[model samples]
Target: MDGISDVAVGVKRGSDQLSTYKNTISGTDCMNDGASNGSDSKKLKVDAAPPSRVLHIRKVPSEVSDAELIALGLPFGKVTNILTLKGKNQAFLEMGTEEAAITMVNYYNSVPPSVRNMPIFIQYSNHKELKTDSSNQQTRAVLPAVSTVPSLSSDNQEAAGTSPVLRIVIDNLFYPVTLDVLQQIFSKFGTVMKIITFTKNNQFQALLQYSEPAHAQQAKQALDCQNIYNSCCTLHIDFSKLVNLNVKYNNDKSRDYTRPELPTGDGQHSLDSAVAAALRKDSSLLGALNPLSAAAVVAAGKVALAGQPGVLLVSNLNEEMVTPQSLFTFFGVYGDVQRVKILYNKKDSALVQMSDCNQAQLAMSHLNGQKMYGNVIRVTLSKHQTVALPRDGLDVQGLTKDYANSPLHRFKKPGSKNFQNIFPPSATLHLSNIPQNVTEDDLQLLFTNTGGTVKAFKFFQDHKMALIQMSTVEEAIQALIDLHNYSMGGNQHLRVSFSKSSI
Candidate 1:
């Protein structure tokens, strides 16, 4: 069963999900007010909005802002509306289309849940079958999920007498099995709701749930002996022992099942005094607020304190020691930062802002669990985030951009169509069968960030891929890692394997 949230974040958005969605369907500019229209008026239009594939997001980070969640959901396809229940750790997301949803479900299930520290969950949802009208609850166990689950006809919502619930015994579960990998396995047949696995005498076992009986049948038929994870050792699948073994226990939150915090996170952004003041203002930062780790305390009060809200704070830094530029220098490695500031006593910790909250979130995640310089830095979305003064200038000695614009002065055709146009001769990649969606602009963005200067970019007509030349191997490696598993408007992941050139 999927958990529902009843906590309203201020006045709840209206149920006009269709028009509200059509207005800001991309979720880019939700802050701007939009117009209203009658169903008849909308029907009068030429193209009616197409139905979107719905997604069920399980175990979303409680502190993730609605805006941040929307941005993260964009990779799946176009997001319509991201509805989160404030107190509830679950959410329901609807994607622009089913194809995009499929790609999202499969891809994100491999994301390891440790990106920025806060875990992200996405699976295909089959909410239609969560029937209500007095169905047998005993043998019929129902589940909900979003994106990339196996297909099923609407015929068997509830098997008349609630035959034995399919018992799926999963093997090869790593000592610390991850949610991402677990989702990838069970999402094959149906929505997987619960996983109960504990080691016995150095062996592991788990019970998986499927939304439909047909899904259980299909999974048994398709993956009975299939080697999961490319393992040669055959996995065991059993039928006829179909029965429900639901085990519920008190969650201790201290269990190691949670993903580890990133190595680089710390709240060194604030001064010492500010950390104390914010803790004084908000008493629960160091204490437990909701059974997760202690509320995060940021040293972000040193730069400038604005954008204050209700994120629990806990820290041990002197806010005055932090500077916006210092934190910017520390954080710029991740991506472009948009703002920074410190709050509390106006002298301690500062909240550093990034061009996107997703980047900031990613930074905060891994950084929260480590020590920096001398003190331990705790990083999480502050229930309250402060704003800092704008405008910036920084050192450029070690960066590649400074060198890209350096005085090589050997002027080639600025807009050359030469096969080796953009890159220098030495480091080149024979990217084959690249989808047409990968444009020169996208390639430039991909390569430039990795320290390569794309003097020229082109596409091949015969097989659809392009030949990219890099100035150095460092740049090429970065490009390969960052864009390795990319999807370009299709389900095909951007595969990056070594290729030997005929040259």
Candidate 2:
């Protein structure tokens, strides 16, 4: 079929005959114009060689193991052999057939491949096949005789009645995997509807549900046995027996993205507490906390005092320019700011109440020392548990504002990417949701009106997102405060946030 031989047929070609073949096949001939050293040693590079059974990958991360390299080819077809040139950070992967290699090259060309967050380039190699000495020790370790590729395609799964839920178990748990990490990785394939994580039988396990069974099958085919980190925290995924997951809470342990109004549970502790308890119970559970969980721990502090009360005292504001609405928009980046009350008598100070204790702690930790309206503001937990509203007849001059029902809350939805993208104010701002009609000049002029010099501007390839750098961090903050959620002549509202990247 399609001139592609089956893997079983390739295996019968005899490894002994293949081993005697020289390893002089050129991997970069397509790009280098047929130049070769005529030696086995070669530096693999991106090429546009004619379709073959082998593919060349460049810029591979040094820590990448054999399994990770194999995973790069598994989703497309059977990987019969692999050769990693660790010293050169390159690898040559041999698929079972030329058609499979062509499919892999096309798919990766569109999506790209990355290991440990480092982008790698892939292309077809001139070599029709790989011939490594089967007797070599390193070859034996990295090359498998034949990989058991999953034959369950989307069509097959649909006919078999596959479930939308996937059961995940993390083996070699050297890192604390949080719900946010899982969501970020899996959501790339589809819309993750819900997730629930817990430890069972002294092993960390999770149940994740996709919006469709096809999405689950695709994710399973891609991520099963893939390492979340360098060589640890490998994911072992399978179709769950249940058709769907029933998530009850929108907390660190479990989340339901479709149900944003769900409570964070009555007495739920942060994810760190659960991980720590598991570690105490089993010494083998020792591992480092990921950035998301570490940030949560640092924000919430000790488990005994993890409940930091949902009120914050913010001071040293530019009273003339500060308003409850401004504070709501600024602090909403971390969590939902429920109510904001600018103290009438002390116009320089205000009390901001968040949706919950965890949100308050997060807002305080991230915004404590940020600049606002030309003033370095200070944010700390207030003794008051909540911000009190004005009396019925008291004329507070609109200083006291309640935003409990505001539609601009960034973290209102569970498993939001915003939760992982929180950064301190910077000179660079990320602008998204731009209308197709909005041009660069329009955005440049809009920010210039805020009295800040637009140093540089860049629109992403899609044109819907961009990065604009201001003259200073304070200017960027002021621009963000003024222009965030501003309408751009269409139903779409502009989304602005401090970016860790620069144009």
Scored against the true structure, residue 276 in model 1 reaches a CA lDDT of 28
Q: Give per-model CA RMSD.
A: 21.4, 22.9
Candidate 2 lDDT at 42 equals 47
Off by over 4 Å in 2: 1-305
lDDT of 2 by residue, 235-321 (tens): 777776566666667875688766656687753532344433433443232233343421111110121133347888999999999
In terms of TM-score, the best-performing candidate is 2
Among these predicted structures, which one has the highest lDDT? 2
Question: Would you list the C-alpha lDDT of every candidate in the order shown?
Answer: 0.38, 0.68
| lDDT (tens digit, per residue) of candidate 1 on 1-503 | 01111111110331222222233223221111111111112211223223236665545555654434433444333444455543335455555567656656655665444213445545555441222223323212211122224444455434412422333333332111322333344444454444433322222233444544566555554445433322221234443233343323212101111122212112222112432232234211121112221211111110011222323232444454455444443444333444555454444455655544434443453344333333466665664443434334432221112112312111223422221111211245546446766677776777787656655445667647776766643344445545554666566655442222322
